[model samples]
Every structure is written in structure tokens, then in C-alpha cells.
Target: MSTVDQDYQLPGGGANITALPKISLHDHLDGGLRPQTIIELADDIGFALPASEANALGTWFAEKSDSGSLVEYLKTFDLTTAVMQTEAGLTRVAREFVQDLAADGVIYGEIRWAPEQHLARGLTLDQTVEAVQAGLDAGVDDVQSAGKTIRVGQLVSAMRHADRGLEIAELAVRHRDAGVVGFDIAGAEAGFPAGKLREAFDYLAKNFFPATVHAGEADGLESIRGALFDGRALRLGHGVRIAEDLVLESEDGDNSYVSLGPVAQWVKDREIALELSPQSNLQTGAIAQWGNDLIDHPFDILYQLGFTVTVNTDNRLMSNTSLSKELFLLSEAFGYDLTDFEVFQLNAASAAFLSLEEREDLADQITEGFGRA
Candidate 1:
């Protein structure tokens, strides 16, 4: 079966995890394209791919992204974005992204992509956004026709290494009423801190736009601090490195004492959602400081401390995973049960860039679905 059609169950023959409703907050548009779609689109554009076959192309992405450096892992995007330059390519990929999410039982998702990258094919940034929105609408309609419900929004991302932060921020706000929900800055996060895009963040704040900055993934505590202070980020994308601020004081049998630094305290106390992608974190070496495995992920530690932790599949194709698969792996490693899974879903719903009423509705849907399971 395909990855989207794969079923996952809780440990010891528990409920089917794939059947449970989930929310994806940090999924990337350029990172989630289907391999077969890439092959066809590349052929249409006369672009060469590393692998000719669909399965092999998919495997190539997985293998290339497994390199232990975030910079090296991101190089794979050169191929995916190459095929996504035209209106048709963008629309088709956006539509299928939603369908695949629905197949994986995601009720809601926020698709993020950098529009500036697609402009190489003579398409303007605004046109790129419109094309993606059209595809998102088509995907939602298709899901409804299939007797299922799925809602999605676009998160326009600005490449941090580029000089179009303010422009892209305006682009996102301009499409607020259309389908765009939020703004983000993604790319090499270490050197290009959010402070570098202070003008963009200032504009977003003045316009009352919400943002979720990509911090704590390829950078450390200072980058996260910049996201909060300079960017005014409402939620953190892969904010796993905040664990660096936590100091293990002592351990007493079943009791352990830990002290949180100011940054960690602020995030935990304010409940800034951390979009933790397990498999992606492992592959990209995001958790290398702590260890090199899923069990070593700081997700459990942050969750235990009452931080708002939500699970995600950051790059479905590159990681060769689904939201169901990420949750299943966490359950297997941490011995989590239905309750823990439900908490994670509810956390994501709460962190979603939706209004309070809409977020509550999503929480109710999650509660009802998990109750039946």
C-alpha cells in the first residue's frame, strides 16, 4: 500500500491511529509533492531528475534528506521547486497535497511554501499565490464530494536568506481574505535570524497578522528568542531546541527536578505551540545534541513540562512518513496511549492559526473522533 493508505495502530493492538482526526500545523508545500507528479512535471518542463522511476525518485529524496546537516537536507528542495514553477504544476500539487492529507486522516492543514522560488518561470508572486489557492479550493471541494471533510489554509513563507521579507509579508497579508492564514520565515535559520527581517515582522504586527516563525530547528536558543521578540511569532515551527535552555537539576528515583531558562519559561508559560516532526527531526539531526534517535527527541520532556507540543510530518515525501506514522512512532518509543495522542491533537487544534471559535470547533471534532476510537 502507499504511504498515505498505510494504517497504523497503537501498541499492543490498540485503536487504529490513522482513523483518528489530526491537525497538521507545519507541513511545507514544496516539501510534500508526490514523486510521480514530480516525474511527470519534470518531463513536461524538460527538467532532468536524479531518478527516472517514481519509486526510485521518492527513495532518492528520502536518502538525500537523511544527511546529518540541515543545509544538506534542504538541497533536495532544488528538484521539487523546479517542477513547481508554473500555474498548473502549483495547482495540481496543492490539490494532491490536501487529498493525501485527507487520506492520512488530517482534518485540517496549513500549507506553507515560498512564492519567490516559483517566480523563476515568469509567474509573479501574486499569481503564484492565486494559483495555489485555486488548487487548495479544488482539493477541499473534492474531499467534500468524497463524503469527507477537510479544511486547509496557506502560510506564505519568506526565505530568510533572501531580501524580500517585507514584500512577501505584504503578499501574505494581501491574500488574507482569499486563503492565506499566516506568515513565516524559513531557510537557513542560524545566521539569518528573525531580527534580520524586522521590517517584515513589524509590518505583519501592525496589520494584526499572525505568524509562526521557523526557529529552534537549525538554530539554538538565540534564534528562538529572535523569533519571539523580533518576529512576534504566535507559534514556533519545530521549536525543539528550546530544550537547550532547560537545566537538569537533580533526579530522585521517579522524581526529577529541572529548571527552565527565561526563554523556555516564556514559551511554556505562554503556551507557544511547538510543531515537532519526529521523523524529520531525526533525519535532519535536529535532535543530535540530545541523541540520535526518536526516543532521544525532546518532545516527551517538553510535553511532560506542560509545553504546548503538537506532532507533525514536516516533509512527508522526504521523510517518507505521514502524520499517522509520526504519532505511531512516538507511541512506540514513549509508550504513549490514546490519552496522550488526543492531547497532542488538541494541542495542535489550539495552536492552529484560526479564530478562537473555529479552534474550539476543531477541538470538539477531535474529541468526538477520538472518543469513538
Candidate 2:
């Protein structure tokens, strides 16, 4: 079966996780292209690939991304982005991305991509955004026609290492009414702090736009602080490193006392959602300090502390996973049941870049769907 078609049941076999309504906030458009689509697009563009066959190419991406280094995991994007230079390439990949999300039972998703990366083939920034919106629209139509419902919005990202943050921020804001919902800064989070994009963030803030910054993954608490203070992000993309700020004070018979540092406290108190992608975090070594396994992730700790934690499949192709698979894996590792999964979905619904009414509608859908399941 295709990755999205695979059925995933809750641990001990209660509900089919694939059929559960879900929300995805941190999925990458460039990173989720189907391998077969990449092969055809590369062939059309005369771009050479490491492996010509579809299955082999998919395996190559998975293996390469399994490396512990975030830098190494990010290198897999070079191939995926190569064929996505043209309007047709972008549209097709986006359509299929939405289709996959729908098949995996995602009722809402916020797809993020860097427009500057697709300019190599001479398409203007506006053209790229328009092309992607077309694809997203087509995908939504396809899902509706198939008797399934899905909604998605674009989250335009500025490359942190590339000093064009202000330009990209303008691009996103210009298309806010079209399909863009929010702004973000991605790519190399360690050395390139959010402070580097102060101008862009300032403009976004002035325009009253929303943003979700990628931090606390490849870096630590300071990176998250920069994302909050400098970027003024509404949500944190993989803010798993905030666990570093949790100080374990003392342990009793069955209780352990912990203190939250300034950053963690602010995140919890403000209800900033942490977009935690379990498999992606493990592959990128984002949770190495905690341990190498899903059980070792700080997700449970953060969730128990009342921090808004949402589950995501950051890169479906590179991680060879789906939203259902991610939830299933987490359930297996932590013995979570349907109730826990529902809470995660509700957290994502609340944190989506939508109006309060729209978010409430989404929550209603989740509650209704989970009730049926």
C-alpha cells in the first residue's frame, strides 16, 4: 500500500488512527513531494537524480534523512526542490500533497514552503505563490469530489541564512488574501538567529500578520527566545528544546518537582503551540539530549505540564511517514489512547492560523469526528 493508504490502529487495536480527524501545522511542501512525481518532473527538466526508479529514490531520501545531523537531514531537500522550479511542478506537487493529507485523515493543514528556493528556474516570487495556490485549490476540489473534506493554507517561509527576509515577508503579505495565512523563518536555525530577520518580523507585526518560527529544534532555549522576542512568533515549529529550561528540583515517592525557566514559563502561560514531529525530531537529533527514542522525547512532559503540544509529520517523504503513522508511533511509545490523540488534535485546531470562529468550527469538526470514531 502507499504510505498514506496504510492503516494505523491505536495501540491494542481500538480505533483506526488513519480514520481519525487530525490537524497538521508544520508540514513542508518541498519535503512532501511524491517520489514518482519527482522522477517525472526531473525527467521533464533533464535534471539527473541519484536513483531513477521511484521506490529506490524514496528509499534514498529516507536513508539520507535518517542521519543524526540536521544539516545532513536537510540536504535531502536539494533533490526534491530541483524539479519544483516550474509552475507545473509546483502545482502538481502541491495538489498531491493535499490529497495525501486528506487520505491520511487531516481535516486541516498549514503547508509551509520557501518561495526563494523555487526561483532558480526564473519564476518570480508572485508567480510561485500563485502556482502553489492553484494546486492547493485543485487538491481541495479533488478531496471534496471524493466525498472527503480538507482545508489548507500556505505559510510562506524566508530562508534564515539568505538575507532576503524582508523581501519574502513582503511576498507573503502581498498574497495574504490569496492563499497565504502566515509567515515563518526556516533553514539553519543554529547560527542564524531570528534576530537576523528583525526587519521582516517588524514588517509582519506592523501588517498584523501571524508567524510561526522554527526554533528549539537544532538549537536550544536561546533560539526559542529569539523566535519569541525577535520574531514575535505565534507558534513554535518543533520547540522541543524548551525542555532544557525545565529544571528537575526533587523527587518524592511518586512525584517529581520541576521548575520552568523563563522561556518555558512564557510558552506555557501564553499557550504557544509546539509543533512536535516525533519521527522527524528523532531523525534530526532534535531530541538527542533526551534520548534517541520516541519515548525519550519531552512531548509527554510538555503535554502533562499543560503546554499546548500538537503532533505533525514535518516531512512525509523524507521521514517515510504520515500523520496517522506519527500518532500511532507516539501511542505505541507512550501508551496513549484515543483521548490523548483528540487532545492533540484540539490543540492544533486552536493554534491554527485562522480566525477564532474558524478555529472553533475546526474544533467542532474534530469533536464530532472523534465522537464517531
Candidate 3:
């Protein structure tokens, strides 16, 4: 089943979440490639896949990622990146990625991917970035031609397990005016702390560049601490584990009394946005301490605690999900109405790396769209 065409409507026929305006803050470019596109790109490069057919390949990705292991979940990206080593592959994937987001009603989205992983075809970092930018521009033009509005920016990422943090950071800053909006470090969050890339974060800070670090996913509170204090992260990637710091004191009649640890209190008080991916968090075991189901997630806890909680699809392909599906799942699990959905979109708009004016404009767009929905 391709999630691309899933009919996800709010319960009681309230509203169609897909048609609602959305802002995606933590979507991955490499992770959201179309399954058929991957098959074509892989065939062009003579790369073998676990499944040759598009539907089977999509199922393979979802199965491999659903193994309840972060390392296993990440291995699926190797096949996707293998096909993205050339200019045509990169451009087409990026172009189609935008079209997919626009089709899903994303008003604004930040697509993150690591250039270091795409250098196998003898393309320089700058060339890869330019190719992606060209594709994004083309995608934007196509969207406008269709009488729809969508905006996209790149978040250049450095693989945390690799030693190219400084190089990737420089590349992001170099293309800041072109299309890149920020820098990030992803992959293997536990052993590879953000502090290991302190030099890159330092350089980004010196250049006034913002960063969002992947922490509290395959790691814990200490890792989130490093991302904040050392990496100076403006936001957290799947920081669902930050709930580990909260101590559930007691539950009394539709309410749970909880005590926030220092770190949890800090994140909530500082309004550090938690880019919470409901399905991905379950697949990656990020919320294993809590439970497996979406209802078991600390998202409702964080949201009720006044944390800046935003919904995201970390890997649409792997999870067989869309942002609307995620929102629908949360609504089904938590009994959220259109107003609750509005809050999530507004949270994402505020956390976008856009200027204050642009963020406000996005907020207005979301508000107006939800008003009509």
C-alpha cells in the first residue's frame, strides 16, 4: 500500500488533514524518495535491490525499518543514497520530493540530506548542492504552474559517524544564500555525541548559522544536553526521549501528575521544539521506555506540559507515512480535533528556520487554511 494515496480524514468526518496547510521541519530528502524512482535510479546505476518491483521495494523498506532497531532502520538509506550518487539522480529525486510534499499540502518544508554520502560518483560537495537547488527551483516552478504555493529549503547534514562535519558545515554556509538554510548532524546519535563535532558547530555559530541536532532518539538526556550546550542546537531531531527526564508522580481521573527533571524543564521552558515523529519514534525504539503504540508516546505529555511539540514524518518511505497520516494517527490515538491539529501546524511554522516575518506569514496561512477546513 503506497501511503501517497492514503485517504486519511479526521475522525467523525471532521476534516481532511491532507488538505490542511502543514509545515514539515524534520523530513529527510534521502528518506522520502519515491519507490519507483529508486528502482529506476538503481537500475540506471546497476545497483541491486532487495525487491525489483516498486511496490515490493516500498514494502521492503517499511519491513526493514520496522525492526525496532535504529541501526537496522538506518541501513535502508544505503540503497537510497547509492542511487543518488549522480547529478540526474539527485536532481530528479529532489524534484519529485518537492512535488510529493506539495501534493501532501505542505506549505513549507525543510529537506535534510548529507552531501558526503553522495560523493561516490565523483561529484564535489558544491556541485551536489547546486544540482539539488536546481531541482528544488524546478519543483517550485512546477508547483506554481499548477496554481499551488509551496516553499522549500535545504538542511545540509553531516553524518555523525563520519569525519566530515566541518566540511559539510562549510558547504551548508557556502550555499546559505542559494538554497541551504541550516546545518545538521545525523546518524548514530548514541556514541557519536554532538560534542564530537563541536568544531563544526562552533564554525556555524561564528557564521551566525542555525543548527538542529539529532539527539534523544537513539540516545538519552545526556545526548540532548550535549546537543544544546555543545552543538548549540536551535531544535532537536526526534527529541522524544527528552521525556525520560519527566517523572510520573501519579494519575488521577483523566490527569497525570508528573515532575519534570531539570533537562525536561529546561527544554519546555526554553520552548525548544520537539520534532516528534510518532511512527518513526516507535519503529526506532526511541520511546521503548514508554510503549509501542502511538498513544503510548510522550507527545501528549509533552504537549500538555507546554512543550513546543510538532508532528513530523522522519521517513515517509520507511514508515509508509505522510504528515497527514501522522496527524491523523495522532488524532485517532489522542482524540484531537481540528483545533488540536492547528496547534501542531502553528508550532511547526514557528520553529521553521524562516525569518520572523516569513514565519508569521506561514502561521497566517496555516490559520486561514484550517479556518476553511
Candidate 4:
């Protein structure tokens, strides 16, 4: 319904990517706040920032995240979370986040954030969850009032390096009936394995709750193995490194052959969704073993191999990107057309943590929108 869809379009005069319905999974709430919002919240809390102006602060975040290390990329969240300690800051950011997603034509989204990181201002875990839920509800109402339809859910995350996995898991379960849909474990994937959170995973499994683990991004195949076996992850966050399990054998004229290791085969066979973020993967050096550019990304290989691949903007503000922009860049890189884009959206819709009927409705909405475009 937004008329501001002229910015992103397919090559060769095809449909505009921004106007197409989309689904966003693996988007982080703390990583998507506006730079101007950060400045205002920082001012209210008397917190010092690296840059004074909004544009400069935005550049600062992008620059910091481009350091080619996941640890360095994660340091930018400290500033965003600092201002988000209070109720007002959290609500405003969540509201604007959903509004931005709707304007970009996202019909459904799941926002993941670690509640334990926002407890600096004397707020309990449940209170933080309530504040964010209130904001998400308000944002949905705002979108509906503007003649657009959008739905959002929360994926509560536990910081892997911290010792509160069970606590965070319990917090998520407490808010499951409200708006929380699933659970996730994020932060520093190499040294902190999914096995570290076995108790948390066990509890979620016992309660029949779904989970998605951050693996194969900062780490390698063993991390992914743990994510699948120990964490029992239904979806993988930035699972680009699963490509490591692929072995290139030989290539004849116009023909190349490759073999998948057991882990990669299992993931592909089981239809586990891979939440791949192109720009963020390049920035964090998650695909550095392949090459430095998007063309070198294994997304194409995985897609061709029948893997369940879904595109995302892992940290939109940090990567200076949106879901539309990410899809546009992938199109430019891999020569994707409207059909390819539709497949990506369909994959995300199928992987969403919703009832089968809800997913079918979302698929119908997506098909109708794409058909009209």
C-alpha cells in the first residue's frame, strides 16, 4: 500500500522488490533501531555516543560491524542496548521497527532479542518482555490503521556466553502465550557451543516448543552438529558455514560435481531452514573461506542443491540494509528474477513458527501479492 516503492527494483525493468510481499525471520530487535532514535534515547539517558549526529552515528555502527569478526560485529549492540534499558526506549524502538518492516512490504516477521541484556535499569525479565510486546501490538495496530496488514512475533534469545540459559528459557516460556513464538541462543558461537545450553534445549523439547540456533556462522560443522543434535534447532541462524561440509570433486565442460558431507545432507534432507543474510555474512566474514564478494557466497550452491534457503538482513542498521535491499543485492549477484524471489519468500513462510493454517494463509497472501506484481 505504500507508494514509496521506487527505490528497489529488479534489473531488466521487472517488478519492484520493495512492493512484493515478504517474510523476515532471524531479524534482531536490538540490531534494527534507527540511528536517530539511538541519539534521542542516548540524550535522555545522558549516555555518550561515538558520534553526535545521526548520519555520523549510523556510519559509525556500519564501520564497527565491518571489522570481519563476529565478536567485533557484536560490540555495536552494547550502545543500542544501553538506551533500551527503560520501558519507553524499548517500546518506541519496537514500534518503529515493525512500522519500518511494514513499509518495506513485510507481511510477517519474528523479532529476536536477548532480554537479559536490557536489565540495567532495574527491570525484571517479565517486565522487559511485556514492554516489548506492548510495543509490537501497537505497531501492528499502526500498520492496520494505515491500510496495510502485518503480523509479528517475538523469539526470546539467551546469550550463549552467559550462564542463564535456563533462566532465559523459562522467561520465554512464561511469555509464550502472549507473543513469544520460539527460543534462540545467540552471541559468540565459536567457543560457546549449543551443547552448553543442553538444559535449556531439553526443557523446550519437553514442552514441545521450537527453537532456532545460531550456528555455522562464527563456527564450523561441529557447531552446526551441536545445533542440530543437542539444541534440536528447527532452523539455523546464518548457517552459511554449512557449506564447509561440501566438497568440490571435478568439473567437466559446463558440468560440475560436488558431494555433501553427512551433516549437510541431513540438513538438506530434513528441510531445516537456513536463515542466510548476504550483506551481514560478508561483513562478519562468515563466508570468507569461499571469497570476499556476494558471488562467492554458497547460497547459490545450497539453493541448487535443494536446501531450504531463506534470505534475511541479520542486522539491518549494522549492515545498512533492508530485506528488500538484501534481495536486490542477491539478485544482482546471482541473477535472480521474480520467480527466485518468490521461492525465497515461500521458504521463509514455510519455516515460520506458526500453525499450519497460519502458514498456509501467509503463503496465499504472498502468492496473491506476487501474482499481482
Please count the clashing residue pairs in each candidate, in the order shown: 0, 0, 0, 0
- Candidate 2 vs candidate 4: the TM-score winner is 2
Q: Estimate every model's Cα lDDT from 0 to 1.
A: 0.94, 0.95, 0.92, 0.93
lDDT of 1 by residue, 238-302 (tens): 99999999999999999989999999999999999999998888888899999998999999999
Q: Taking the tens digit of each residue's C-alpha lDDT, what string does model 4 give over 1-373?
A: 1112235889777788999999999899999988989999999999999999878888899999998899999999999999999999999899988998998899999999999999999999999999999999999999999999999999999999999999999999988999999999999999999999999999999988899999999999999999999999999999999999999899999887999999999999999999999999999999999999999999999999999999999888899888998988899999999899999999999999999999999999999999999
Per-candidate alpha-carbon RMSD to the true structure = 0.9, 0.9, 1.1, 1.8
lDDT of 2 by residue, 224-261 (tens): 99999999999999999999999999999998888999
lDDT of each residue in 1-373, candidate 3, tens digit only: 2347666799888788889999999999899999999988988989999998988898899999998889999999999999999999999988988888888999999999999999998999999999988899999998999999999999999999999899999999999999999889999988999999999999999999999999999999999999999999889999999998999899999988999999889888888899999999999999988898889999998999899999999989999999999999998999998999899999999999989999999999999999898
Candidate 4, pairs of clashing residues: none
The deviation in Å at residue 349 for candidate 3 is 0.8
Clash total of candidate 4:
0
Which has the higher lDDT value, candidate number 1 or candidate number 4? Answer: 1
Give the Cα error of residue 335 in candidate 1, in Å: 0.7
Q: For model 2, which pairs clash?
A: none
Candidate 1, after superposition: displacement of residue 110 in Å?
A: 0.5
For lDDT, candidate 2 versus 4, the one ahead is: 2
Q: Please estimate how well model 3 matches the true structure, expressed as its whole-model Cα lDDT.
A: 0.92
TM-score of 2: 0.99
